[model samples]
Target: MAETAAQFPEVQGGGSLIVAWQVKGKTVLVVGGGEVAAGRILHCLNADALVTVVSPAARLNPEVAYRVAQGQVAHVDRNFEPSDLDGADMVLVAVDDPAASTAIWQLCKARRIPANIADVPPECDFYFGSVHRDGPLQIMVSTNGKGPRLASMIRKFIAKQLPSDAGRAIETVGQLRVRLRQIAPRPEEGPKRMAWMSKVSEAYPWDEMCGLSEEDIGNLLRFYPSGKVPALDELKAMRANPGADKEAFDGSFGFSVGA
Candidate 1:
C-alpha cells in the first residue's frame, strides 16, 4: 500500500489572523462611553465607519463627548439596548460591567455579527493591533492579545527602520499601476504589464520613485511595450529638461537596479 499524505488540522497555530477589514461606510455600534470605548470610537472613525455610541450622557468621557458634540458620531443618550444591534455591521463592547459585555458579545454571536469586547480575548472576534500609519501605508504589529505594549514597541521599531519616503513611494507606484492599466487595457496584457511594473519597482530606489513626475511616468509607459526597465539617469534627464526631444530616447539606455 502507498503511504498516505499527512493530514492537517484547520487551525495549526493558536492565534488570531490579522486582517485589514474595510469598514468604510458600514455601521459600527460601540456600546460604552469610557476611555476604552473612546479609543474604539476613534478607530472606527479612522476607517470611515458610520459610528453610533450607546451610553448614558453622564457616562461619556471628554473624548467621546467631544466627538458627539462635533456631530462626528451619532449618540444614544441611554444604556445599550438589543435594538442597538439591529443594523450594526460590527459591535464593540467596552462597558465597565464584564457580565454586560459578555451578554452583549453572546447576543452578537447569536446574530452572526462580529464583536470585540475590550480586553477579553476569548469574546473578541478581532483585536486592534498597534498600527503605524503613513499616508497610504499601514504597518500593524499584533501579539494575539498577549502583549499589547510589546506589540506597540515592535511597531515603533519597524517604523523607524523604514525610509521616510516609503509612503510616498507606495502612492506613486499605485498611480503608476493605474496608468499601466490604461496603456494596456486588454485582459491578455495583464501578465506582461505586471512583469514590467515589477521590474520598474525593483529597479528604482524609494526616494527616486517618490520623485517621479508626470513626464517620468510617461517615459516609463514608453518602455512598457518592450517590458524594459529604464535607467535612472534617463528619467532624471527628462525631468531636468522636460522640453527635450522625445524621439531622442532610443530605448537603448543601460539599466541598473538601484542599490
Candidate 2:
C-alpha cells in the first residue's frame, strides 16, 4: 500500500516570530511609570536588560517608585523626550496620553527601532504575551493583540498540566551535557558525543532522568568512549555501590540475555 501524504490547512495570517530573545546587557527604554509601565520594566529587568524609564517622578506608581528607589531601574523624572531613545535597543511606551504615546511610536519607527505602544496594536512593532516561567523554561501565549485575557487564560491552563519537576529535569540534562562536553573536548568527536548523549536520554525516562545526581552522571561518562547506554538497574547498582567492579557486570550493562 502506498503511504498517504499529510496535508495541513493554510494559516489565516502571518503570526509574529516567536523567539527567546537574548536581551542581557541590552538597553531597553520604557516611556511611562504607571502600573502598565511597571510590568514592562519588571519584564525587561528579568531579562537582565538595562532599563530606563522616562516619566515624571510624580507619575510613578508605587511599584515603579519602589523599583526606582532600589536602584533596580533608572528614572528620567520627566515626560518622553526624543533624546531618550539614544542607545536604546528596544522601546516600550505605556503613557496615559495617547497623543504623546503616538509621537513616541512615530519616532521609534523613523529610527527603525522596535517598539511596543500600549493599547495601540496598529502602531506597535511587537506585542507582549502572557508568560509562564519556570527555572529555565518559559511558555508564552499570544493572541496577536486580539484577546489578551483569553491568551492569559490559556497560559494558566497550560502551566497546570506541566509536571512540577519539569524545569529541574531540564536543568539536570543541561548539567549532563556540560559534563559530556568536558569528556569529549575535541571537535572531531562531536558526532559520537551527540550519539551517546541521545542514547542515554532515550534509555532513561523523565522521572529517572530527573532523579539523576552528579555521581550518576560520572558513572554514565564511563560508557561514553564505548558508546554504550547503561540500563536503569545498572545505574541503580552503581549508585548503591560506588566501588563495585565494572568487569563483574555483563556486557549488556545489567540487561538479561535474550530469553
lDDT of each residue in 178-229, candidate 1, tens digit only:
9989989999988998788889878986655755677788887888898898
For candidate 2, write residues 1-259 as lDDT tens digits.
Answer: 1233235554667689888777799999999999999989988998899999999999999999999999999989998889999999999999888998889999999999899999988988778999988888888899887889999999988777665555776888899889989978999999998898889889976645655668788888888888998897787677766445443233341221211
Leading candidate by lDDT: 1
**Clash count in backbone of candidate 2:** 0
lDDT of 2: 0.83
Most accurate candidate by TM-score: 2
Against the true structure, what is each candidate's TM-score? 0.83, 0.85
Point out where model 1 deviates above 4 Å: 1-12, 205-208, 241-259
Query: In candidate 2, which residue ranges exceed 4 Å CA deviation?
Result: 1-14, 206-208, 241-259
Candidate 2, run of 10 with poorest lDDT: 250-259
